[model samples]
Target: MSATEIPEPQVWLDERGRPCPLPVIAMAKAAKSAHGSPVIAVLADDPGARYDIPAWCRMIGATYLGEISVPDDKGGSAYVVQISESAQTDASKSIG
Candidate 1:
């Protein structure tokens, strides 16, 4: 998929107002439980997440689809990640 293409997230994680690490931690957990979903979207306000989530994806071999702005009422933006079937397998193996 193109860098600008963001799939509809099969799993949505709302981590707005949560501190650093928490957003990424919740994202990892959500991703682990996604059951082969193509995309997982994490809603977070933490400035750190703008970097941390992508970094986590890199470390885990998942595709960081990039972030999209959320409505002000919902918070700042949502971080989108694409997990390939192979990446899911890799992640599961690593987690287990």
Candidate 2:
């Protein structure tokens, strides 16, 4: 990782058995905790989470930093997503 890039923390939610919305919700909470300056790597096996995570980032004014698919032994895809800072007033004014 570069000095300008803060490596995100990866969380593997074993809720692959629970189904849709729960994984999305968990990812949202995780992202919220990593709200500023760093990203959160949300690895979810739920298919819905692939879309829901990015959508949540959009709704919350955070940057959807893209994702990578991870091979899982449990027979599902793992999504690596990065959530950037929220676009608050002070955040918007920063000329970087």
Candidate 3:
């Protein structure tokens, strides 16, 4: 879906200033505890997140909604992900 069409994120992960892989790792943990949030927005300043976030989403079957640029004070933008219903079902099945 378009960035504008995507819903506001229920889970917000702030990983600004952290290094590569850390942001993605935090995002993964946050996503796991999201409890079916439609969207999870991760604020990361790490350049690797520009690629890792989307890659992680693909690996987990989540939809990479888009990235939203934060103000200069925030350091960088946020990568928004939409956790698909199918993905949630799959996760639940795996846990059960």
- Model 1 quality (TM-score): 0.81
Q: What is the per-residue lDDT of model 1 for residues 15-80, given as tens digits with 9 covering 90 to 100?
A: 898988998888766666777656888898888999998898888888898776663576568889
Ranking by lDDT: 1, 3, 2
Can you give the lDDT of residue 52 in candidate 2?
83
Task: Point to the candidate with the largest lDDT.
Answer: 1
In order of appearance, the predictions have TM-scores of: 0.81, 0.58, 0.80
Candidate 2 overall Cα lDDT vs. reference? 0.56
* RMSD, every candidate, angstroms: 2.4, 7.3, 3.0
Model 3 agreement with the true structure over 1-96: per-residue lDDT tens digits: 566776778777889989988888777666655675468888988888999988878877888989876635867878998887666665455445
| Local distance difference test, candidate 1 | 0.79
Backbone clashes in model 3, listed as residue pairs: none
After superposition, candidate 1 runs with Cα above 4 Å error: 1-4, 93-96
How displaced is residue 17 in candidate 1, in Å? 1.1
Clashes of 1: 0
At residue 3, what lDDT does model 2 achieve?
A: 26
